[model samples]
Target chain A: MIPLGYYIGLSAILFTIGVVGVLTLRNAIVIFMSVELMLNSVNLSLIAFSAYSGNPAGQILVFFVIAVAAAESAVGLAIIIALFRNKLTVNIDEVNILKW
Target chain B: MNLEQIAFLILAVAAIASAILMITRRNPVTSALFLVFNFFIIAVLYLFLRAQFIAIIQITVYAGAIMVLFLFVIMLLNLGDDKLLKWKLNSAKTISVLLGIALLVEVSYFVLHFTSTEGMSPNAESIGTVESIGKVLYLNYLFPFEVTSVLLLAAIVGAIFLAKKKFE
Candidate 1:
């Protein structure tokens, strides 16, 4: 049996990548995709802990998280579409209308 | 180590590498594709953890459904590379990358040094099966399960409302 630390470490690295993507990337869709990556990494750690503890609750929570992520991405993408329709661009840096 | 450890290492490497590639790709479509690959690897990792139900859900919901939505948005927007290239490496980006690396190092330190006294239940192997998950989900988690349906419905309505052509 592998130590639980390995999974946790992997999850942490993935999460950091997501954070860097969100921080540095300007494409709105890519940013959203990075957010999804972050969520998936969190789910990984949750399942790892659940398995390590022999508790099903973490897995159940992952189920809820997945459902929420689906809903969030649907709504988020729709909002992005609306923004694109109004601004003619999906780049976050260019979409700033409230700056002034 | 054994097969499980080896599988974990391979899947973990694949997942992390794909994620980095996904973030660094210039094209949104390519990035989304890499994200799909990352999701699939994570699903396989779930299988390694014996969470078969979550593994399947991760594949179907994340890799399949969510990625399709992302691709559709990417195609619909049709953003040009010139527009995406507006942002360059600035101070904020450098600091963010530094912070991210620091966070990773700190978390790894904790994870590597931490110890737990609780032992896994002997029946841990069976907990991840569909039947077992279904029991806990429907019995103890019935309320949250129903709430999830409601949330999905709300999201659907909200999305349609947002994306619909303004009739003004």
Candidate 2:
């Protein structure tokens, strides 16, 4: 069996990549994708721990996470589409009237 | 390294590469496609972890359902051209990258330090089976499972309301 550290490290790296993407990428859609990436990394860690601890709880948790992610994606993408409809752009920087 | 180790290495590399590609692509469609590829690789990783049910869910739900929604929105918005997109090679970008690397280092250090070398549980195989999972899910976690259905309903209604062209 591979060391548990490997999976955790991989998840960390992926999570960081997702964070960087969210930070740097300006497109709302890509930002949403980055969010999904982070969520997936969390899933990886959950399953990793679940397998190592011989517990199915983590697996069940991941199932809920996936369900939540599905709901989030549907709602989030709709919001993006609505924002696109009104603002005519999905570039996040441009949507920052709230920032000022 | 054994065959399993080798397989893990390959999958890890592929997953990282695709994630990077997904994040960096200028075209949203391309990024979505790379994300799909990354999901497939992660599903294989889940399989290796003995989470057979989660692996299938990752494929069907994430790669199948969610990605299709993403692709649909991308195409509907006609966002193909990104020439005038707001991205630039500047200070904010550089600092975010540095912070991300710093976080990666911190997490990896903690993981290596804290993780026990004791690997896979002997009973991991049995617990990961669909029947065992269903037993626990239905008997123990029944309430939360039902809650997800309600949550899904709310999301569907909310999405339709938000996406509609105008209110009557």
Question: Candidate 2, A41: how far from true, in Å?
Answer: 0.5
Stretch of 10 with least lDDT, candidate 1 chain B: B79-88
For residues B63-104, what per-residue lDDT tens digits would candidate 2 score against the true structure? Answer: 999999999999999998587664678999999999999998
TM-score to native of every candidate shown: 0.94, 0.97
- lDDT (Cα, tens digit) per residue for candidate 2, span A15-66: 9999999999999999999999999999999999999999899999999999
Residue runs of model 2 more than 4 Å from their true location after superposition: B165-168
Best by DockQ: 2
Model 2: how large is the Cα RMSD against the reference? Answer: 1.3
How well does candidate 1 score on lDDT at residue B159? Answer: 97
Docking class of 1: medium
DockQ of each: 0.72, 0.82
Chain A TM-scores, candidates in order: 0.97, 0.98
Best lDDT among the predictions, by candidate number: 2
